[model samples]
Target: MIKVVKRKGKYLVRQGHTRFHGLKLAISEGANIPKLSVILIDYKNEIEEYLENLDGNRSNGLNPVGQAHALAHAVSLGYSVEELAMRYQRSTTAIRNMLKILDMPLELQRLISLNLIKKTLAIEIMLKYSNDHKMVLKHIEGFLPGVKNIETTTSKIVGIPEHNAAGAGPDTLNKGGPEKKNSAVTRKTLGIKRLSHKKTERLKSEFLELVESTHTESITNTQTELKFGRDSAHLFKNVNSNNVIFSNDGVQIILNDEKLNILLSLLNDENTAIIVSKPKLEELLEIRDLLKEY
Candidate 1:
């Protein structure tokens, strides 16, 4: 039933907008809305309470911008975090995040209202570049190539150039290939001791072995499951969670089957998150030394 307040011979709808719109559509289609029901209200007394409750009872299915506006209105009406959270059926943290959406740059708000960008991405831009709406738009244009006139930042891709990625052409490599003659010279110029080829190879091999031994899914934002392997049990043990997985927390490499990509997950936040202390600190230093030398 539609609830409305009658004032000066006109009605102001306070709820059931969907039903009212449906009645309009039905009327336009030459169909009967004979069973329409509405509750009358005393405009002077109930309107304020009705409006307040309306803002607080916003449906979660509303658009992100609508949700933000409704939540913001609730906050402005002296609604506490706990009250808003309960009314919105969300956590207090989620309510805070919703309110934060209004504080984002105006350009971001527009994009969100138009559904061009997501709420989370908008918040990320807001956090990164407070009010730099130009930069935020430029960054957003990168992920959405179809959006025209955004003047994307066009950052240079940091990898092998397409022409050199694979080359059988003449300019690719001269007869002796690139020279390592200057490699040892450059090391000497930096006052660093250069290892012999045999020693370097041995060190590299050992470094790889150590990396494999220390490989674990205990690293942050990374987890692995044994899809199918004969030695899956041992693999799982090496990669499983442990309060003290290593003597020192560092970057751990996680290999995934998707595109055979190797992911480097930082395990650096040791003091509070991951318990990282043991008698095997020397091995970790050995890994560090090999990394430094290489």
Candidate 2:
């Protein structure tokens, strides 16, 4: 798909590959060439250009995991939350929330991909427990041990303070005696308040049990499978996790961690060092000698 922007009197390509060979082939063969559709995009600046690029390709199998990587890369490359929000067609709050989700474990990513867990619920759990995986897992499994109270969990997401006027007096109020305590109690008990602890725990326990029993094993297995695949690829094919390239001679060059460490070690040593074989050492010394002469 080609995207174009107006420049002067003509439409100029803003994104997409300009493959001329296919058109040439069609023209030469006198085939009835199909008309290609072009999309016109309007961008105020470079930020918009980056957004357009992300959005245009995003719909093509860009799952939550893929989006996490892409968005993280954009962030590392200095795109601010506002710019990312505008580009991704999301609110700034959503962008921030999504960025937080990037730190999710592989198992959670698997669950997200399978649509087994709702993004909102995951975010709530993460926020409530400060992204402690153990707490998140235990809470999901219907075991709210220790301080993992439903009241605290709901309060954070629902925008209610843990200890309000009735529980803990407002900061501006002076420390006082029974009169202030009575007023606070009266205010708390007067109207409809949070559910009783028993009812809340019962409902939460049921909900968590249902969610965990349904999804946990599958997601955990998926995480294990993903890890195995990556490790196997590196071991058998010499295809590292990142920065792998195939040269024209059909050789794969991977600037992976092991290779990088070796290279750095060789560079740090002033004298010729043994690396791989004697010829390799001679080649390095030759390069060093050439650099010295220059």
Give a tens-digit lDDT track for model 2, residues 1-294.
677777577875545533434665777799776776778877766545544555554323354544555566567656888887886587666666566656765445444434445565566555556568877666554421222222211211221112222221111211111221111111133232567889867866664554333222222212111123333344546444444433333333344344444456678757343324545444433333322332
**Top model number, lDDT:** 1
lDDT of each: 0.48, 0.47
What are the models' TM-scores? 0.39, 0.36
What is the C-alpha local distance difference test score of candidate 1?
0.48
Model 1 regions lying over 4 Å from their true place: 8-10, 21-36, 41-61, 129-138, 141-294
Each candidate's number of clashing pairs is 0, 0
272 in model 2: Cα distance from truth in Å?
74
Query: What tens digits encode model 1's per-residue C-alpha lDDT throughout 130-188?
Result: 44667755665555442333221222111111111111111111112112221111223
